[model samples]
Target: MPKLSVVMISMNEEKAVGSVIDSIQEVVPDAEILIVDSSTDKTAEIATEKGAKVIRQYPPCGYGRAMELALKSASGDVIVTMDCDATYPSKDIPKLVLLIDQGYDLVNTTRVLTKPKYMPLGNFIGNRVFALCTRIRHGIKTTDVHSGMRAYKRTLIHALKWNPDGPALPVELLIKSVRHGYKFIEIPIDYYERIGNTTLNKLSSTVWTFKRIFCKEYFD
Candidate 1:
């Protein structure tokens, strides 16, 4: 079986990080769990106790930087990126790996099917607008352009460059993957309310995404 590497970026997620790691272990016992944590709380300590390789992101780097650090440290055939807030279902990991084994280069998890009521109306609208922009500008057809959970071959990282320093990393990944002619697949996954306060500034992130889309930074 190919080795699976699960990379999660966390900050002050002590309440949910341990449970998330446990869930991932239950589903993929042999999988490597890498946590890029910049938490002021015990999040890193908890993840360490749970057997996850913890990389303490010093000076409090942003989410994109954290993800980049985790990706650089990952050593697996396949890479799975998700949040450590327990919102993403670890039970669906096998299904994602199965898709990758079947020759898909990238598999993105969509939260639209479950339609959690806790999702803010502004975020829903922002996501739709971003998806529309992607389809119109890049001709990539995907339902959830901003979904956090995704799996892809580790080698695909070599073919693309990530530029966003904030929450726009997911969109940039999809855009680059499509531009590079990688096979893409989307699977509907269950969504749950997050356990702690969200650090996302939806307005700022949305503006950044739109700026990138219109300026064609994704192509460059």
Candidate 2:
């Protein structure tokens, strides 16, 4: 079986970091857990003690920079990215990896499949609108453009270019990779309430997502 790497980005997610790592271990015991943390708390320490590699991105790096570091630093053939806040299902780790083994290049999880109760109403609507825009404009047929849980084949990472700077990286990567003809799949997953307050700046993230939807990378 291909080696698995579970990667996450954290910023003051201490409360949920340990539980998330434990859950991943239960599902994929041998998979390596790598975290790129920009926390001012115990998030990195807890993750390191739980056997995850902790790469510090202190002074509160933005979401895109942190995620980019985590993804690039992973050493597994199959890399699974998830939020450290325990909102995504750990049980789905193996399922995503299974898809990767079956020849898919990228796997995304859909949290809005049944109206996630934990997702705020504004976010829910915003996600749908952005997803629709991606489908119509870019032919990227994802129902949740910002879903944090995803699996990626490592080669796909090298096969594309990434310019991650802020929270809009997901949509940017999705648009470019799918346009580049990489095989993509999405599976339904449960979303739970988060373990800490959200650090997202909704207005800025929303604007960024829209900007990336038309980012020339999709064409060039």
Candidate 3:
């Protein structure tokens, strides 16, 4: 069996990290947890107690850069990534790993069908619009381009050659994966709102994100 590594990127997530780790631990007891945290709180300390290897990221760094650092530090053949906040069900991790073992290059978790409550309306609009853009530009129809929950095989990760190094990295991942002929699919997964503060300022970040992804996908 291929080893699975669960990687999470977070900052000041002391409130939700424990539950997220606990849930993933329940599903994949043998799976290793690697946390890349930049929290000023006790996030890293708490993560270590929960049996996760913690790597502290510096401030002024984007989520994409932190995730890149986390992924590079991972030691498993199959990697599953999610936010440090307990918005995604770690219990569904095995499902993603199973799909990967069956040979899918990338497995995306979609909350669209799951109909998670408390999700921002702006997020819904942004997700649908971005999904449409990705389909039209890359011929890949994905239910959740903004979803933080994703599983990917190590080989496919290399094939994409992604280096966005910013928050728009997930979008880059899907686009490059499709461009490289890698197989990708979406599976329904439960979603929830975060327990603590959110990193995004919806209206402002949405505009910025749209510009960033549009330039990378269409112009550049």
Q: State the lDDT of candidate 2 residue by residue for 70-99, as single tens digits.
A: 889999999999999999999988899999
lDDT against the true structure, each candidate: 0.86, 0.89, 0.81
TM-score of each: 0.96, 0.97, 0.92
TM-score of 3: 0.92
Sorted on lDDT, best first, the list reads 2, 1, 3
Task: Name the better of 2 and 3 by TM-score.
Answer: 2
Query: Candidate 3: what lDDT?
Result: 0.81
**Candidate 3 residue-wise lDDT, 159-188, digit = tens:** 556664446677777666766778888998
The number of the candidate with the highest TM-score is 2
91, model 1: CA deviation in Å?
0.6
- In each prediction, how many residue pairs overlap at the backbone (N, C-alpha, C within less than 3 A)? 0, 0, 0
| Residue 94 of model 1, lDDT score | 92
